[model samples]
Target chain A: MTWEIFNAIGTIAFAISGAIVALEEEYDILGVYVLGMVTAFGGGAIRNLLIGVPVSALWDQGLLFLMAILVITVVFLFPLRALKQWKRWGTFTDAIGLSTFAILGALYAAEMNHPLSATIIAALLTGSGGGMLRDVLAGRKPVVLREDIYGLWAMLAGLLIGVGAVNQTWGLYVLFVAIVILRMMTVHYKWRLPHRTIKQQEDVSV
Target chain B: MTWEIFNAIGTIAFAISGAIVALEEEYDILGVYVLGMVTAFGGGAIRNLLIGVPVSALWDQGLLFLMAILVITVVFLFPLRALKQWKRWGTFTDAIGLSTFAILGALYAAEMNHPLSATIIAALLTGSGGGMLRDVLAGRKPVVLREDIYGLWAMLAGLLIGVGAVNQTWGLYVLFVAIVILRMMTVHYKWRLPHRTIKQQEDVSV
Candidate 1:
């Protein structure tokens, strides 16, 4: 029951986020739905493919698909002026969705007896893969790769799971909350991942 | 034997193409290899995921991976002045890879008894999907989506296979050559798919 609830929340949040990006990019209605569905399911699909899950298994989540579609439609229909108020909420919900999906991915990989590295990879992909796809489709730089410590939170969740530190139901819940809080803190503090330009290196050599 | 040969052609050509793009974007050596690998295998991986092929099957082709890596390394080490001469050939080789992969994708889907729509989709994805992934990772618009009639040839190949119009070995070769020629002609003539900007539509409405 908890799993289903968390999944639903993540799906709805991702769908809304995708819809917002599509709107910002001025995509057509079809593009809006396409992006929304991709954002909600693309990460899981990518993870499943990598972890040897049957791709057809994706089709079984009919309810989640419907929920995502409904959420995206509502977001699309909401007044533009009113939608501006939800911008801050979008970040909060996105953080929740990211942490939830990351933990779930780690748990799933662990249950499959995958190695620790695979578990961590699964978590990172499931947590940020959808956003990467969205940014790619929208022709923007992937924020997760270039911005704050977003993927680190997912890796942390994966490490916690792989080490058997968050096995119990209460423990999983606690981990979820902790990840969300940490992600939000990074955002609040404007944390950034270190990056260096090749151009700078070339200039130094010259 | 023929199938393996075509796969090699596609993989090598794609790797070089990807490496060139990475160099153009001034990525580090690691980025070049990552992009090269993604461009070579991304389309096939995506097609496998969508068509119920076990994605782990991708790892079995150790030789192909090695070949791609070698090709990328060679391209990376080549003289930059000499590399400029191959720009025209890049288009030719890319066309070959695109057509070869598209036909192969269509045949795979048809052999699996997928519907014509799925076969066409598979072909399109397999042909252009890698390039799309490359462009997205490079933080640029996907040329496949924005320019030319690139995907049409893939769809046509899928349609031919799905309809059993090109079942013989000789017929498949003929179809492949025809697709390459058609794609080349489209490029030579600068043919473009029809597109409309939302800004133009909004301007008209106002």
Candidate 2:
């Protein structure tokens, strides 16, 4: 099914991205695999929990697990210099993964009769949760919380689906494409959410 | 009834600890409250997911939310200098929270007929998951992953409970107390998990 294909693509994409981050962070082999697996599955796990899906169900995705492992292994086996374009590849795949997963998460929640808020939350988590976990484990701030308008697009996609504005299969595909394009555009333009920072002196007093 | 009481204690303790960390990190008021709530409930949310509990069930604990908020507010109201002993207080409360939550998580998973692996995972996550999340949100490595003998006691407690070596109310209480004492002793003695670090030079080739 199309859904299965999208899921596989997202999983492979996230696993490779995670492996890259681990390598960049100079993590050992075990750490690399752990980060890769977490990045590939952490989002869906978080979303499942939010939408009342049994976390045990995660273990049922044997093929997906295998796919992620394969991707991670490939990433590790390749020389970093040979993958000089890893950054570009990572961004492209990340955009695809995020879009596909966001739509999938929203549809799953909506199908389960979750409310708009829950659906939106599910989409956001599914789209960015794994990457956030990967960054945290790498001892960095979660880019989703601080960087470009990332999670918002996922939430918007979820909102559209939850509101029944895009329920058909073709409609879902269109939405996915739109999301990916939007994400790419945002990154291209360096779009960011508004931020607030208290002065260091004032912050210390409080 | 006792379980509810223990849960409250854990919640309060974690909320306070989270608030303190947020303060130390110089995060804003919003970040402080967010971290506090995450620390108090994130673990249970994770454990529930793993054990097949509906995450929406998290919303059912209105009293817990109120308690966390109250604690965060109180923590913020106190002057930082006045709370100079916060590190000591935080460690003591964290130990209590960790032990109680670990036991509770293991018990919940065991009662659900989960396997030993799931039970132990639940226990570890319940005990340290929130703290890990808080640290990540604060942009620090998880203390549970890096510091002394923290998660081991939780795993041991879970292992005991999972194997039915300790199941009765009295047995559970004993296990909880033992974990707390062991944790405190480890901290006092500066005990740590055996660590291995590959040289940066060696890590790059792989």
- Docking level of model 2: incorrect
Clash pairs, candidate 2, are none
Query: What is the DockQ of the complex in model 1?
Result: 0.12
* DockQ-derived CAPRI band for the predicted complex in model 1: incorrect
**Residue A88 in candidate 1, Cα distance off native in Å:** 17
lDDT of 1 by residue, B1-206 (tens): 66788888988888888998999999999999999999999988877877788767899999999999999999899998978987787888889889988988888888887777667767877888888789888987666655678877888998899889899889988998999999899889987654322221211100
| Alpha-carbon deviation at A26 in model 1, angstroms | 9.0
Residue B108, model 2, lDDT: 93
Top candidate on TM-score is 2
Scanning candidate 1 chain A in windows of ten residues, the lowest lDDT window is: A25-34
In order, what is each prediction's RMSD in angstroms? Answer: 7.4, 7.1
Which lDDT values do the candidates have, in the order given? 0.81, 0.82
